[model samples]
Target: MKKIWEFIATGFYSGKLPKMPGTWGSIVAAIFLYFFWPENIVYQLLIVAVTFVSSVVSSQSLSEQLDDKDPDSVVIDEIIGMEIAMLGIKATLPVVVAALVIFRIIDIMKPPPIKLFEKLPGGFGITVDDMFAGLYSNILLRLLIWRHYV
Candidate 1:
């Protein structure tokens, strides 16, 4: 059970990869969604919801077990965030690439309220910040898509 949580929290060990583990996690997530995402928006949202809860649970479990406030390797947050960024958006390569870039930028910069989410305790702290980044990316990507830029 703990092993399972560890796997989830680590984003299937994409988190352990050398250099930019979050990017690795995001790549894994983007690929997964590109291939396996549901046709319906509601179902896509359901998948994100389930993964969101799983992220909180698994990330908190791993954080407690490892005695880390926010481990670099706990990148399930990135997976969830990446999924959120692409939610209800078409999964074309250009769109995916644009969403990925935007998501990574917001996540790294942690602008405005996105940075504040890190103050929350435990896994909530670890995850919500990226969720906001993804949200920001989603909004920006939507605009870009609407303008036919992506």
Candidate 2:
């Protein structure tokens, strides 16, 4: 049913927040990462992969149902993006905080190819730009860890 798709796409209604729903959804994602992130890198990758697939399906369905390209009320993309950003990283307090900040900034800024990804059709358009932002956040986080900057 559409409710199911809406549930998934809205990150279980976190996206229904009156303001900055994406940020609220990302916050929910950060909480999920803090409590549930896998210890094994392989499993972490699997989680991201699954989240990506689910987000794509749900987002596309929700968009069509709502007749919008990228509905503000659909933020499974943010959840999946934060998941990707936190992938393979230790879920320490500092790391979680930094990941949230970085992912949000990159997502909001939408630099270069991140914005371009929005041009894709359906949920691919809805979800991938956030994934790219997460990728950028992941790379930056890894670099900071490598450099002992964080």
Candidate 3:
């Protein structure tokens, strides 16, 4: 039970990486999700939902473990955010690449409301901020698709 809890909290050991584990975990999760779903809207939505819930719970546990506002190891937030960014998109290589780049940029920049969201309390703060970043990336991707693909 304890081990299971740890696995769940750490995103199956992705959070334990020595450096930038969260980023690595997110990238890995994105890749896994891309292959696993491959343009299936239902699967994509399921992934987004699962990631969102798991991230919130895991991030909260990680915060308690680290005794900090938002530890880098708490990267389930990034995983969830990236998954949301990829939602509703064809899992093509180009689309995936674009989403990754755009999401990374927006997440790192922490613009406006995204930055503001980070100020919220506890895990909610940690997860919501990244969720907003994901939302921003999703909107931008939609706009791009509409402008060119639609």
Worst-scoring 10-residue span by lDDT in model 2: 141-150
TM-score of each: 0.96, 0.96, 0.84
After best superposition, candidate 1 residue 69: deviation in angstroms?
0.5
* Candidate 3 lDDT tens digits, 57-85: 76777677778888776677877778888
Error of 1 at 55 (Å): 0.4
Which pairs of residues clash in candidate 1, taking residues 3 or more apart in a chain or in different chains?
none
Residue 111 in candidate 2, Cα distance off native in Å? 0.9
Q: Which RMSD does model 2 reach against the true structure?
A: 1.0
Which runs in model 1 stand beyond 4 Å of their true positions?
none
Highest-TM-score candidate:
1
Query: lDDT, candidate 3, residue 21?
Result: 71
Q: Write the per-residue lDDT of candidate 1 for residues 1-150, one digit (tens) a residue.
A: 999999999989999999998989998888887788776899889988888899999999999999999988999999889888998987888888898889989899999988889999998889899999999999999999999998
- lDDT-wise, the better of 2 and 3 is 2
In model 1, the worst 10-residue window by lDDT is: 30-39
How far out, in Å, is residue 49 in model 3? 2.2
* Model 2: per-residue Cα lDDT over 1-150, one tens digit each: 889888999999999989999999999999999998988999998888888898999999999988999999999999989988888899887888889999999999998978999999999889999999999999999988789876
